[model samples]
Target: MAEDIEEHEEDTPTGRKKGLLIGLVLAVVLGGGGFYAAFSGLLPIGASATHAPAPSHNADEVAFVALDPLVISLGPDRGNRHLKFAAQLEVEPHATASVSHLKPRVLDVLNSYLRAVSINELEDPSSLIRLRAQMLRRIQIVTGEGQVRDLLVTEFVLN
Candidate 1:
């Protein structure tokens, strides 16, 4: 009985020797892999044509800026000869170059798009979400692929 108890004790996990060895080996392999991946640039950095990061701004700061409102005149049939809808847009700070280069194009697309939208679409609350996506696509198209990161509508009011 004594001999059997001694054998059982020896067989049971009594120390951190194996665990420590495994941990060290795992750490070494993982660290080496990470270093190689980073230094070799094996990890995907991204496409060369990718847009720059958007400028970080607190919600308060964004809200503080009184943006110039865009009044798009949707042609008749909804009401009078002209129906006016309001829109606001946001561009990433890093995208300044792309935005500046394609400002005219952005404005043209925005105007045309707004002009074509039905009154009902403009009036719906959730419509702004859909409109933002549309505007983002249009802006990207105008600015060239991967130019604009996003479009934020600070204000979307139809009057």
Candidate 2:
């Protein structure tokens, strides 16, 4: 009986090792296939569609009034970094002239506010949004309500 069992065991080479190798090969092939499919852009289901392209607006509906660039010195010692700020005001086509005339006052307000801001706040990445809102509010106040629509920051560099 024992000799018969030993002979049966040696007759076929099917065991855990063969099944494990087959499973591993199958997994690797499927994984590679999936990667290639996604990378080739053939799998549209996996593609992201979170945002849509911005629609074109009426060009003549709004106009931008550009302000002169300002270079504000930073730090009390005056040997430290300086801020170069440039921006434009979005207003109706008719308000452009009025906004342009008040450009000097706008620059003064912006320069004063920027100088008063701490260096740490200026360096923070998230602080830009808050800073923009504050600056916009100041600009609207200076230019009077309904004259300015938005404040678009074109350049903000600290060196």
**Quick one: best TM-score, which candidate?**
2
State in Å the error of residue 119, model 2. 0.5
lDDT of candidate 1 over 1-159, digit per residue (tens): 999999888866755678888999999999999777765657644332133366887654332111245666555656653534334445555656556666666777877887888778877765576777887788777777755666756555555
- Worst 10-residue lDDT window, candidate 2: 44-53
Q: Which pairs in model 1 have colliding backbones?
A: none
Clashes of each: 0, 0
* Residues 1-159 of candidate 2: C-alpha lDDT, one tens digit per residue: 999999888765666668889999999999999888876666743433222255465987889999899999997675688999999999878888999999999999999999999888999766787899899999999999999988889999989
Query: What TM-score does model 2 achieve against the real structure?
Result: 0.63
Q: After superposing candidate 1 on the true structure, give the runs of residues whose Cα lies further than 4 Å from its correct spot.
A: 1-68, 81-94
Full-model lDDT, candidate 2:
0.86
Looking at model 1, residue 72 earns an lDDT score of 63
Q: After superposition, how far is residue 65 of candidate 2 from its true place, in Å?
A: 0.7
Deviation of model 1 at 27, angstroms: 58
Model 2 deviation from the true structure expressed as Cα RMSD, one decimal place: 8.8
TM-score for each predicted model, relative to the true structure: 0.50, 0.63
